[model samples]
Target: MKLYVIVSLWALVTITHQIKTQDNCVCEFISSEKPFPYDKLKMMQDSASNCNNLMSPQKAFGLESLLLGLNRRLPQLEDDVEMLEKEDDGELYGVLSLYVIENELTEIQAMIDKLNSSTSEHKRLGDDTAQKLEDVKEKMEELETFDAMQVMKKQQANQRLKRDLDQCRNGGLHPRPQPTKHTEGTCPHGRFLNVTGPRVFTTGEYPGSYKYGAWGRDPKPEEGKESWHWLVMLTSSNIYAHYVRFYSTLSSIIVGVSTPGNVLIHPSNPTTNTIQGPNVVLYGGALYYNCYNKDAVCRFNLTTKSITTLQLPKGTRYNSKANFCHLDECYVFTDLDLITDESGVWVVYTTNQDFGNLVLSKVEEEENQLLSLGQTWRTSFPKSSVTNTFMVCGVLYATRYVDKNLEEIFYSFDTTTGKENLNVGIFIDKMSPNILSLNYSPLDQMLYAYCDSKLVSYEVLFEKRSNFYL
Candidate 1:
């Protein structure tokens, strides 16, 4: 029996020594190079722990060497991890993590299998051994949960990236449809020079059902008038308002010039009463207009004959005060606001006295208020004064007569800045002089001045030389 006991002791020692040597060999191999094989490193670590009795100083040195190798390759490992994240390789990461766990668990399983295969007469393991087994099992479960979570996160990130790319290609924010040429044509006189004036019939011996047409005739140009065209057909000379004119850029249209005759209005519920110029603006699928002397902003629904009116301020010239103020001559069409917001129509008008006092007021939802003085500015010159009432670059400009020589002066003012542009003038010798209107066209980036009852357009030609007004 003693001999048997001695023999068993010797076998155990030999087995322990052999395992130690094997672990050392593995560690030595791991420590040899960078990008240490993680799977192999993990196996060695597990082997060293699984059979601690086999460990020796040389094996310990080998284990330390493996740790050093891992440290050296740490930066590379980090790069791999980052790349993995960018690529959304959750499955790969999970697989690697699982491999490490499986290697450890497999070691435990091998030991368990060895214990099971041993003779029944052999000694049993202690409580500590059983506890270690249970711990390993718990670690495997945790790893499984971690793997699932990583997979879900990667999938979500991938979906978000796809959505962002799609938005970039589709113009996520301000998607605008491309504009196409409308061969069918717009208003016959070109895009109707949008006007805000009244419609009156021809008086005298002209017989017609609809005696007159709305003025501010922005008709498309005719084919032959490209060089110097003329649209002269005035059904009536009685222009109650100044909103009856528009100029065309395209020469392929024929806008009728004034015809020799009288003007009249179709009698209606309001007796088709005559008013001032039509205050017209095209916006939101409708033409907004108001009678020359009426105290209301009227909307003529082209889609439907439905006429809607919004009340103007009590002080507007559209009332009896307007006729009297006009020296009993009646107010004519003035100008319409180019910009339309939810607030209401912004109309600028001239007083009948011609002293050059311009009024700025808003036709709100249903009320009008003469804008305060601070909100308005006027331009004055030698013999004439004009209100800088028109808008360009969100700023308003007004012109005035500097001399009887027809030298004209203009000033630009910012409604928001309250700053004014320096006075500037254009000179053309021997030309009839009249400051009909000044306009800016955003489409062509040009500024126009109407003088001598004719139009002369100028290229603004330079950047705002100075925001001296800034």
Candidate 2:
């Protein structure tokens, strides 16, 4: 049997089916003689995109108008919970507040039920907030059975973890070096005054994939690589990394056009000497970082492929026991922060004996070229209160998160004078919400901040001074 069929759908597409053969009929549809117009199909796709881009100011697409203040009300409930949580004697007032919280929890549940958002982020936030609200309500109801002080302490810790998790879903330092007689040689500039610019900003090769990292110029870089920029991304579970990425120049990183060279800490990752946090810094020709899950620092020399370890005090915190935190988030496993300054490399950390206050130690290379900790100092500033810390001219500057767009340096600990100033008050205009790793490079006189997943640099503005009294 032989058959022929041709169908033309109006202003759309055409199809032809034909069968011609004796025994086993062969069918030939659209052929080279009359090919489908792929150009027209592409033009239709362009038109569809244009329609998608069309805009109309309409309230029907969102939930607030339908629910009469769903957006306004949800935030209020969250704020109320935070406000109550911050009160020193939270549980002392808990008995009276529990009823109100209970009412709020019920309302929150009702809101969650009423929400018809197809957005996964909205649904997840509602579900998670409802669960946490329920848990917090239970704790508030039971606060009567517990001691207020003990409950406060526990709540502080719980609040830290809660902020930590919510951030998982969402999301200083001092100076020091000894002074010399000549102002040009030592402490030439006055105290750190201000910071400006993203002087440089880039996502690099990995971009949004990496949320924790550090990037900067190695102050005393190896001969030819002096112009190179180094990046240490905490590539494993946000806890560790085994390689350092190298870019030839700053522009190369910003443009993200060049292939970066990688130097592996170990051929096998999570083995000995793997970097534990984003606080690692490259100084000279060596990379200094926290020893994996240990109260120690590891220096991996790039030229020699050799390593050196410096043990911290017995009570020193490691393995996420102490971390850099702000109201919004905590950078975990940051127990040991390696920093570099004009003098040399330094380690900023906290210890149990110090009650979680910042401890600074100088990392020195002895005559034998071995690294060791020297000149131990302690500061009254609590580590948990700060979002990050860095050093400039032997002065430790500490920053607390003011908001997503701002970080305020409200504290400075001068190692030489053993003086603490709570009014340093220098503010950084941030491009991202968090600065996980921060260090100052005397080589460039710039501050490098690994802000969330982005690498940003700031010019360290100093007060001009001709001479200084050592």
Candidate 3:
């Protein structure tokens, strides 16, 4: 009886140990592809009840190892839950802020609607009041009558005024006076001369001056005209408010001419309205200039009184801060220059693709539109190295920007022969140090220059001897 009781107790102990081992077999649960939800800390307490049944002792041992590994990572899982809770709080705050904003927007919309209704009411009342005023005016007009004596007096006064106007038109009472000529002195070759004064409005003593400006002669002067006409453009920091002066050989004074008078004012495009460069050429009864802040040329017709624009080739640089310079200083002007010679008008400019070389194009007018004839040429030197350039006959002459007191004409390009010569050594000693403009006149055989805010003329000695066929 004692042996039977001891065996029974040992069997019971073995069964209890097996049951406890089976309960801890959680390998299937821990090895799942999906993660266990540790955010729900209450659910984690019931994890043991959700374990799969053990198939073998080895399987149970593997499950026990997996559960041990998972137990070690419980602290990390708790940290994750805390982070999730913080994110939830942030999202909740954002939603609350959005709700508040929506409410404010609703109130603002309601106020706007109310204001609109009030405005409509006021507008209706104003319309009614206007109608009543119109009716009152009509009633007053109906009651008014014309006076015969007053009418007769008005007719007599009108007749007298008409007679006076007719007499004025016929030059009966007032004889038409002829324009008086104020000749200070005559320039050489009967050229109209002007005293040194500012052509543009400036702050200091040099108001209306062309210190850094451009001047050129009319390429096609009118027939039977004794003197040549020249156009001068003033330079300013403000590119839009540029001033132009019309100088004729007939007048000794520089007349300030605005758009529609000297230049055509561009209505919608302000960039094309003003002239920025120091190169204005008069050709075929039209003034050609470099448009301000644009890579195009502007043609202002003197007869038609209109402006036309001609687009230049792509990559042509103009209106840039980089201007011609020499040893003393650099003059900030335009990159594109309009030049006219005995042949016609040509545009001188530089392009990025040309590798800093100068490009020239012959311009022609057809049907009131300016067109390029595609007769283009390339110069040997870069445009930046040239201080000033002008066309004589069909040849282009370039002066050095350095040693302005000693004007050295070092470069020349012949459009006819397609030959470019450098270091020609031709010099003009009479030019000032600040010679912003240099133009050769084919008519007077003279070189006109705007040097140091004064107009100076130099006689061309080579005009008769040159082999140029103008």
**Residues 1-470, candidate 3, lDDT per residue (tens digit)?**
68999886665444322223744742221221234334433343333222221122223332232233234334434554555556555677656655544543443343345345545655665566566556545643432333324665688789999989989787787442221221222223231221111111111123335466555456567673333345454645523324444532212122121212344344333454566666666676677777777788887776676778888888887666446667667666657777766667888888888877888888876764756556888876888787777777677778885464466677777776777777466565533566666676666455666666545555555412442311
Compared with the true structure, the alpha-carbon lDDT of candidate 2 equals: 0.72
On a 0 to 100 scale, what is the lDDT of residue 280 in model 1? 40
**Clashes within 3 Å, all models in order:** 44, 13, 6
Give the worst 10-residue stretch by lDDT in candidate 3. Answer: 194-203
Candidate 3, residue 362: the lDDT equals: 85
Model 3 misplacement above 4 A: 1-208, 223-228, 238-243, 248-251, 254-271, 402-404, 463-470
Model 2 alpha-carbon drift over 4 Å, by segment: 1-186, 258-260, 465-470
Candidate maximizing lDDT = 2
Clashes of 2: 13
Error of 1 at 437 (Å): 4.4
Worst 10 residues of 1 by lDDT: 195-204
Candidate 1 lDDT (Cα, whole model)?
A: 0.35
Kindly indicate the candidate among 1 and 2 with the higher TM-score: 2
Model 2, span 64-136: residue lDDT tens: 2224334445665677677677763756676556655676565455445544542454566556656655655
The full ranking of all candidates by TM-score, starting with the best, is 2, 3, 1
